[model samples]
Target: MNSNVIPFDFDGQPVHFSLDGWLNATKIAARLGKEPTAWLRKIETLEYISFMAEALGFNSVPGTELEEIKALGTSAPGVKKRILELSKSTGMVRSRAGSSGGTWLHPKLAIVFARWLNTRFSVWCDLKIDSILHGEMSTRVQLDRACKALEDRKSQASQDGKGLSSWRWDRSSLEQSVGYWLGQVQMTLDLDAA
Candidate 1:
């Protein structure tokens, strides 16, 4: 319902997503009969945190600093602040409150959550998120682009004195032949019926 949230049809279910490809982890977790907090707890491990930090373009913290960061714990004020900092700096995870409010995860991390949820769902999540991030084209649009490219190539070939004979066709003749064949088939069917 929030203007910032976009509704996505995911396998017949509507899921909210942010404009920058942040997936609504809360909604997905609920749909999958799991708690977002539970999954969050699972991923909050040092290994996952370090991987996420690096994947999000953050430099690896030194050993002592990393230990200090780990000590902040899930419920600590520092942990909340750190989550906010990570959201602002790296767009890793975010939470908001409203009708559409939920814990949103970056596409990268969303796939991790999906993998944690279900394998098939994870593959679908990966592809859907990928298409969202990288502008998906309709099959018709792709076909049109391919046709245009072929047309350009054909034109070049004609100009180079290597024109393709098979590419030439009489559209009117083709249409007339198709129409006549259809009429003949219809008449035969009508006669058989009578």
Candidate 2:
């Protein structure tokens, strides 16, 4: 009942709309009782509905040409016309001219529109974040930063050796955790002996 909350029906249970994002359980649950074709369409329609709702709200989504109005500027006029018709058939409407020259929701269906819009936005953000943090670039960058920090710690360790015991100086947590100081000492001592 709260203005901030959006609720949806899930397997005969009323569930609160999540701001916490991208859970697969709802999708799985929604498909449980339907025929495969019906279930597939239901999930695809939800994704399509979400993208359509998001595009109307000044969002730049990677939807099909029909769902993304910005895509219309490049396509032929006849094709744009048909895409608009397809949008309306799928329960969306388009606007023309000035600041409001984009698609819009049927006034009677605003709540459904908003729920889908927020879900789409969240999903887009999640994809971007996942791409950044899960790639080879991210792995290389993180390891490079750690190695630089480790070198600085080794320099500090050599300076600390002038004072007395290895434990006396301020040490990196990694040195404490994995006995890096002792490993470095062993390497240095072996080199000196050779």
Best by TM-score: 1
How does model 2 fare in lDDT? Answer: 0.38
lDDT of 1: 0.59
- What range of 10 consecutive residues in model 1 has the weakest lDDT sum? 185-194
Clashes of 2: 0
Candidate 1 pairs with clashing backbones:
none
> Taking the tens digit of each residue's C-alpha lDDT, what string does model 1 give over 1-194?
36445565556666666645678988888888887667655315334645676766764334564456567666765564554444434446667788888888877778887888889888877766665556433432443344455556567657754344533543344445445543443243221110
Q: Which parts of model 1 have CA positions greater than 4 angstroms off? A: 43-46, 58-91, 136-194
Write down the TM-score for model 1: 0.53
Candidate 1 contains a number of clashing pairs equal to 0
Candidate that would win on lDDT: 1
Give, for candidate 2, the lowest lDDT window spanning 10 residues. 185-194
